[model samples]
Target: MKINILIPVRALHDGKRRLSPALSATERRALTGWFFTRTVAVARSVLPASDIILVSAAPDLLAYGQEAGLHIVAEAHPGDLNTALRLGAAAARRKGADATLCLSCDLPFLERNDLEAMIATARPGAVTIAPDRSGIGTNAMLTAPIGAIPFLYGQNSFTAHSAAAKAAGLIQTTLRRRGFACDIDLPADLDSIGFMKNDRHIIAAE
Candidate 1:
């Protein structure tokens, strides 16, 4: 099946507001760039046949996504992450993708193998989520049949996704992968991942 990955990014200035306390504005921008770069790299590595779509309101981010060899969907709406993702998913479906994976751009450690495993395990009328380090936040979600479930992302998103899946009568599965579990949101999270140095490549960034 052709899996299309949708990465929704808000403006660079407001991208990781939660992470601002841990990093300076410059550092946050760099971190955001690294995060987006790593996400695209992982997608490229994992699904060679799969297409990576980046939906963002930031012009720089769109350029970066293009540089990363990903399809860019410029967000007409500036601040709405959900809307951007929805548009991207719709575009993917229109492009004839068999499945769509909505992945958070902050997962620096995500591995190609884990994504492959998730794709292999995917089933019709099912939704899969990869919880964050706290096991409460959702870092990655896969919805078969494209728009099977409404993507509700935020704090406690894992539970919300599970609830949505149950309500929709879709089989729900949670896969705990180390790569997908670690996301950079706070200073402590950054330290915990030991990603303090500047790394251009995904493997080194992680």
Candidate 2:
């Protein structure tokens, strides 16, 4: 079975707005870049470069993705995240993928093993949903047959995705693993990253 990883990224300039209380605009973008790079790195460890798709409305981000050897797909709908994800799903399907693991770019602690375990749970008619540490948000989701379920990706998406999968009669698996539970978001979330709160090393690539 061909499995692909799709990550949809917003423009870095406006990303991580919730952390603005503690970090500057430059810091936020740097953090965004760090996470984006980290996500791609973990994905590359499990799959070939061609199978990891990066979708973004920002041309510079797309260009950076292409430079990293990821399959770049331009998000046609600028501000609509679900539509952008759908476009990534379509791109994965076009590349002959049997399943698409939709990944969020802000997973600071994600490792290669996390991605490998997620792939192992993927089936032809089933989906795997991984919720955030808060259990109120979705961190990672793997949908079979490329886009078997509609992308409901905002505001309590963990429940929304499960409902969508149940409504479609597809088998659902909920994975609550430590590696998949954390994602960088609010100012408080930075404290758990295992380093100094203002450590600028994450954005050293800049």
Number of the top-ranking candidate, with TM-score as the measure: 2
| Worst 10 contiguous positions by lDDT, candidate 1 | 197-206
After superposition, candidate 2 runs with Cα above 4 Å error: 203-206
What TM-score does structure 2 among the candidates reach? 0.94
Off by over 4 Å in 1: 48-50, 197-206
How many residue pairs collide in each prediction? 0, 0
All models, RMSD in angstroms:
3.0, 1.8
Model 2, span 42-83: residue lDDT tens: 999999999999999898989988998999998665767788
* Candidate whose lDDT is highest: 2
| Root mean square deviation (Cα) for candidate 1 | 3.0
Candidate 1 lDDT, tens digit per residue, 111-141? 8898887887788888999899798998888
